[model samples]
Target: MIKSIGTDLVKLERIKEIGIEKFAERILSPKESVVFKTITNELRKLTFLAGRFAAKEALFKCFKKGDLTANYKDFEILNDENGAPYIESKYTKELISHITITHTEEFAIAFIVLEYAEYK
Candidate 1:
């Protein structure tokens, strides 16, 4: 069952001026490291990191039961074999049902569906 949906858009140019590597270091996971490594443009890097930040916040909002301020490092979004993003957390895996993520040049969006499943 689809519990909730959230989406966000970020300005590509805004991130560029700030430096992409800094933004990537702050947001992107170890798996996403490669994505930024090859992206030469600073703005594209910022756009990517901004999108990821938004995706993490969106997933947190959709979580069934938890304090909004709770530290959730495990909740960081990671790319799958196909480059699709998914939440990786022992807590979320047990509480969440499923999720989907998408992005464009100007924005990145993520939808989280809460569910009851065994934690892998």
Candidate 2:
């Protein structure tokens, strides 16, 4: 069964001005941090951070309003060998999540859908 849907968009330029290291520390999980550190190209780094930030924001919106307990680091967005992104977090482990992230030179956008098993 579908539980919730959320979407967010982030400005690439704004993230670029925030400084990669600072932004990564504020949002990236331990494993994500390692990936961020390994990125050598500045554009790739900015897009990576922006995608994660937007994804987390979108996921947070999936919860009921006034639920602000989730921090950016709590939701880790990681890519598989094929470069498909997936969510890894205790909060979302039981729920199936689907995410689509896209970016241009100016903006990054993400859409998230949460689902749970249906019992008959």
> What TM-score does candidate 1 get on C-alpha atoms?
0.65
Tens digits of per-residue lDDT, candidate 2, 29-108, equal 99999998899998999999999999999998887563567798999999999999999998887788999999999999
Candidate 1 positional error at 30, Å: 3.5
**How high is the CA lDDT of each candidate model?**
0.63, 0.91
lDDT for model 1, please: 0.63
**Tens-digit lDDT string for candidate 1 (1-120):** 444555544555556666677766766667677766888875566656776777776766765345645443445676679866677766564565455656677766666666554432
List of clashing residue pairs for candidate 2: none
TM-score of each prediction: 0.65, 0.93
* Top model number, lDDT: 2
> Any runs in candidate 1 off by more than 4 Å, and if so which?
1-6, 41-44, 68-73, 118-120
Model 1, residue 84: distance off in Å is 2.2
